[model samples]
Target chain A: MAEIMSLSEAVTANVNDGDTVALEGFTHLIPFAAGHEIIRQGRKDLTLVRMTPDVVYDQLIGAGCARKLVFSWGGNPGVGSLHRFRDAVEHDWPSALEIEEHSHAGMAARYVAGASGLPFGVLRGYVGTDLPKHTDTIAAITCPFTGEQLTAVPALRPDVTVIHAQQADRHGNVGLWGIRGVQKEAVMSAQRSIVTVEEIVDELNPRVTVMLPSWVVTAVAEVPSGAHPSYAHGYYERDNAFYQAWEDISRERDSFDAWIDRHIRNTRDFSEHLALVREEGVVMA
Target chain B: MTATLDPPSTKATTDEIMTVVAARELKDGVVCFVGIGLPSTAANLARHMHAPNAVLIYESGTIGAKPTRPPLSIGDGELADTADCVVSVPEIFSYWLQAGRVDVGFLGAAQLDRYGNINTTVVGDYDHPKVRLPGAGGAPEIAASAKQTFLLLRQTPRAFVEQLDFRTSVGNAEGGSSRSSLGMTGAGPAVVITDIGVLRPDPQTGEFVLTALHPGRTVDEAVAATGWPLRVSDDLTVTGPPTAEEISALRALTGA
Candidate 1:
């Protein structure tokens, strides 16, 4: 019995300051917009964790909210910059930042181990290089069966897992159109979860049967233009103009906040930016 | 391993320096967690050149792989068929990566900052990011836990940057020794390879210092392309461009 709530309310309720949270999507796909609202809600001293965080991560960390941030690698050349992330390093921000050296699959695999409640998930990502000596969190352990060595990654359970999808029913049956990796595992590994969707449909709808059969979802929030800025594989066209603008803002560390304040923070409706894109249609070079 | 031995030069276009600079980091018997693209190409070269026995592990269960050519991603069959062993993702991490057994972790970056934090996230706001990247695959652990991480990239203001949009992976963040404080005793990033030259982390600051530049390149050019005030080693030297033989070997191996 999941109650439908506003995208913002659901996010504010589930996410708090400094809580270990996992957001759905790979780079740019189905990340919960409501999650961003949660960050904008002004929770501070949080430890943000992800495989590779992009603009959403940048905005949150830049806003001085993150206390300790952990992940693999990040970048966006010819358009955006990691100014706040770099400043946190060059000047050393109040937050403690840890850079785990592994691929996106490696991190997701760790989450899979976490969801399974295993002590540590064995992985095969970095075998020959120096990536192993960086930390003992994910260390190489001996295989009792094969007597061969392997890389063991510890399981991850976040405080909250926020996700967005194509559709969901009143009972919180999620329909993931096309998500990469084990996103479901990430949600299961969380203590609590929130989901946003485009439309509320009947559980017996044809779309549900073809795409997702809702059984493990908790709640659903409908956000029409939610994935507006981020194109949905085949749903809409990719926006390049917005990317260029973001590139400009991200490059200027000092002024980035002002830019975020003007565009991201200033707007009340998340759909406002969608209108800009619709009118301009993504400006491609 | 010996830089002085000049291999015969091969004639080709598309600027082979990026491939050559990346290939120079390989060492025999060393474990390398290789990401696809340029990093994979370089790791393969290491196997063919000096480190014929270098063990390569991909996310898709391949270990000690000697691929004929670089695959698009780790899932490519070349990694598994050519590998000496193929283990599950979790088993590999538990047995090799997390236990601190790997030697070199190779990676590619979309955005990087001064502290060595990387980003593979969006370019704008969270609710509405501009461009979404391909996301991280296994870079988090590879960047943090490897004995040392090597970043292969083309030198440019665009690639080398002041900061990242998101911290996708952690790499000696905060400072050089702070990783140790966080209970990380693994060797941090030892070197970063680019088209121009090679950069090493300073012992104390953990910030990257320019150690070598290409034959016709200048220190100013390297500095100009950096995202921050670039650091230089006390004994910097000009690196010789790849010889004709090295290029031929690289191309023939790549089948490009």
Candidate 2:
């Protein structure tokens, strides 16, 4: 069964140094609070995994918390490049970060295989692309039934997976809707999991599209607006302006460090960080 | 200079003309797997103007998304709220895309070659790149699985390179029947829509041939912009200018 804990407590109890951690949310319901908590806790040498490593992963990579990143895409969404990620890969500003890249199909297949308790996932991908030359995880496999050749990627089994959701019942059953991404698969593929929810409800709403029974998750934390900047379907809208502003704020090393220090490190929690952002006029009131 | 031969009534920008031309490629009800930037704009424009029933699928797992405005990101909540249904990322790639349900894969490229192979990975070496681009998200599989693929890119000497820094998605491979030998299911990159004109692959040789030039864009200008020795079709034709309805609908959808 899962225990209801504080975000800080959940990170302290679950995440450790040198762990393969996945904070999965495509572009919506990203676990920004959990990522912040992990950054604040100063965990190091983590192999961060996500299909799209959005701003949260950018922050983590910039803060020098990650040693490796396993992702398909790393960008600022509608915005241009993720400067911090670029810095890490190009210059290795704080540390030497290694990357193992794959296409979205390959990454998704790896997760599916992990969730299904299989050794690897097969797909018709990377036939003429240069991706297979760079990554060792992708290989050619011949189908047993047919003579067709396919690509096989090893299953991704992360040490810990974190996600943000809309609600969690007292018994720690998590429920989330809107763009469901790979949160369920990530949770199932990991040895331990953390879910930060907007609220702890008496009963999960019937309309919830994805319901995670308590047994699968390790801990649950109630952190309202946990997916700020990113959006929870019914709770709030995506702060696109912030994402645009991040382009400038994260462009330089000094600016990114100062922003992180003032907003994430010095603050007590996500709410405090959010308040600082609002007070500083970084985000609209 | 070909300035004397240019038309005066052409008021539409190159991007607008390109988008309108690309939108015209989508049939009324085809399922289009859309990339984020230019392709998304074109697909949404098609929905708003002609192809109302054209299903737009984003790799973010929003299937049949009918957004009022073009989404900034693929997984914007607007896409989900307006989608017929939403699935997980794995399912979207596996059951929907790799399963061959998508008819047209519309994509944008950072760099492209004559064979239609894309290079969105890097601009230099893989281990040590001069410029690093966002790596392949879904282009490889989408290019390999969708019934046909459409690439949208602004043509330039830099982008239309003779040799790519990295090949992220395969169109026709080396030329001719190379894509077939690789066992890829889809008929790779049917047409490449650019700001200057449309380039379609030759039926006999898989090399992309400059089939049509947009109004006011000279052939010399197109030739000058391409890095490779671009081949022009034997019977080259001029692209029809964007109609008032196309410009108005595109502007309304983009709010530009």
Candidate 3:
């Protein structure tokens, strides 16, 4: 059963150096607080896995916490390039970083295979693309029944998976709705899991579309507005302006370092970080 | 640039024409797997104007999303709020997309070859790229699995290349039946709508040939913009200018 713990405690207890960690969210309900906690804790050599490595991954990559990234897409969503990610890949500013890339279908299949306790997942993908040339994890497999060719990707079994959700009942059952991306599969695919929720409630809302029965999770933390800059569907709207501002803030190495130092490292927690960003007029009130 | 000989009163920009022309390709009630940017705008415009029953699927797992405004990102709350239902990422790719439920996969590209293969991964060497692009997200599979694909990108010598730095998605390999030989479920890119004109794969060669030029655009301009030795259809025609309704609806949807 999941033990209710503080975000710091959860990070300390679960995440370790050189671990293959996955913080999964498509674009909504990203575990920004948890990512920040990992950064604050100064974990190193993590093999970060996410489908879309959004700005949070950018931050982790920039902070030199990640030695490698396993993802499908790495961008700032509607905004342009993730400058920090670009920097790390192109110049290796703080340190050299390695990347193992795949298409969204391949990554998703790998997660599903991991969750299903399968050795690999098969799909009709990467036929004429050069992705297979670059990624060793992708290979051709023939169907036993049809003798037809298909692509097989190995299961993505992570050491830990972290996600942010709307609520977790006192029993530690996590419930979330609205654009539920791969969080369930990610949790199931990991040896350990952390869920940071907006609030801990007496009972989970019945309307919640996806639920984790607490047994699958290792720990839960209540960190309201945990998906800030991202969104929580019902609780708040996406701070698109912050995403846009990130383009400028993350463009330069010094500016990004200063921002991270002031906001994430120095702040007591996610709430404090959110408050400081808002107070400094970095985000809307 | 040559001035339009018969300028319409509505005065639609080339981008508007490109979007309008692309939107017209979507048949009523078709399921479209949409990429962000121009493809999303065109798909949404089609939903609002002609194909009201059209299904717009984003990679974020929002199926049948009917957003009032064009979403800034695939996972914007508006998409989820207005979706028929939301599934997990794995299910979206497997059960919906790879299952062949999607009829049209609309996409955008950073670079493309004459065979319609895309390059959104990198602009230079894979190890040391001059410009690293957002790598293949869902395009490779969408191009391989969606019954047909529609590509949208501005035409430029740099983009319409003879050789891609990296082929992120397959259209028609080597301009022949090679794509089919690979056992792909879907016919690769059917149409490539650009700022200058519309290009369709030749029935015989599978090479994308200039089939129609938008109003005021000339064959010379299209050829100049392409890096390869461009081919023009023998019976090439001019595309009609965007109607007043199309211009207005597109503007309203984009809020531009």
Q: lDDT per model, in order?
A: 0.64, 0.92, 0.93
Worst lDDT window (10 residues) for model 1 chain A?
Answer: A204-213
Error (Å) of candidate 3 at residue B76 is: 0.9
Give the alpha carbon lDDT tens digit for every residue of A46-113 in model 2.
99999999899899999999999999988999999998898888888788889999999999999989
Tens-digit per-residue lDDT, B43-162, candidate 1: 888788878888888755578888787764454445545777655445565567777878888887767666666766445442244554545556666676788888877778876788
How many steric overlaps does candidate 1 have? 107
Clashing pairs in model 2?
A: none
Q: What is the C-alpha RMSD of each candidate to the true structure, in Å?
A: 10.8, 3.3, 2.9
* lDDT ranking from best candidate downward: 3, 2, 1
How many clashes does each candidate structure show, in the order listed? 107, 0, 0
Error (Å) of candidate 2 at residue B225 is: 0.8
Of 2 and 3, the candidate ahead on DockQ is 3
lDDT of 2 by residue, B129-218 (tens): 887788999999999999999999999999999999999999999998888999987888999989999899998789999999998887
